[model samples]
Target: MLLKEVRDTLGTEVFSKEVERAIEKKVRLHFGGQEVYVKQSRPDPDERALAIRAEYNMTNRRELMERYGLGRSAFYKIIKGG
Candidate 1:
């Protein structure tokens, strides 16, 4: 399906079935077995930083640590400037 769509978009005059198959093979070969990490949740670094900074106080340090699942060192680093 994808190959047919690509061939349609590129035009069969330039990319025939054989050419499309070869390109697909090369692409799979190049990208196959690669460890891919896709972020599951919304990752807003700036917003998170602001929230952390606003919420980082002396009293609720443990709460912040627990909410973010960070160790003391990592939480401190993140608040400081991660």
Candidate 2:
């Protein structure tokens, strides 16, 4: 179920807790069925910036709408120094 669907169906108060569990379940389901293997992969400091932007672009519309209340969009727009 999509986050929006979950929120709409369950209401905000109940949905918050449910959503956390839902995400954990997804992560577990994805990994639990696979054979585990360790691999060394050093990350670059620049990667976090890339990841932040990638997440911002990919996050749900429901979250971005909430940003309007907190002026987060404006803050991001004027963000000069990371």
Candidate 3:
């Protein structure tokens, strides 16, 4: 998938410059069966959610929900501190 697609799919939650670079590096290493070489640790869910909220800048809510695999109620719960 294109970088834009990946970014959209990740919905700014877990999407960071470092994460993007890691993904690109992994993809490039895939042909050599060395994809695991670039493996990096992932942030926990709460941290990811916080990052998403911080990074969010008027992106459509519907699109964000869809991309992040969140239900309407779940998304609202996160935003509303419930």
lDDT digits (tens) for residues 1-82 of candidate 3: 6776888888777787778888888878775554445567767879757755765566677877876777888877767766
Q: For model 3, what is the C-alpha lDDT against the true structure?
A: 0.73
Sorted on TM-score, best first, the list reads 1, 3, 2
Model 1 residue 2 CA deviation (Å) reads 29
Error of 2 at 72 (Å): 55
- Regarding TM-score, does 1 or 3 come out ahead? 1
Winner by lDDT: 1
For model 3, the run of ten residues with the poorest summed lDDT: 30-39
User: Clashes in candidate 3: how many?
Assistant: 0
> Which is better, 1 or 3, measured by lDDT?
1
List where candidate 3 sits over 4 angstroms from the true fold: 1-43, 57-59
Which predicted model would earn the best TM-score?
1
All candidates: CA RMSD (Å): 9.3, 14.0, 11.6
- Clash pairs, candidate 1, are none
Can you write out model 2's per-residue Cα lDDT over 44-72, one digit (the tens) per residue? 63563354445465455346436433255
**Candidate 1, residues 8-77: lDDT per residue as tens digits?**
8989998898898898899689878887576789658678768888998878889988887768998787
Separately for all candidates shown, the number of backbone clashes (residues 3 or more apart, or on different chains) is: 0, 0, 0
* Ranked candidates (lDDT, high to low): 1, 3, 2
Error of 3 at 29 (Å): 22
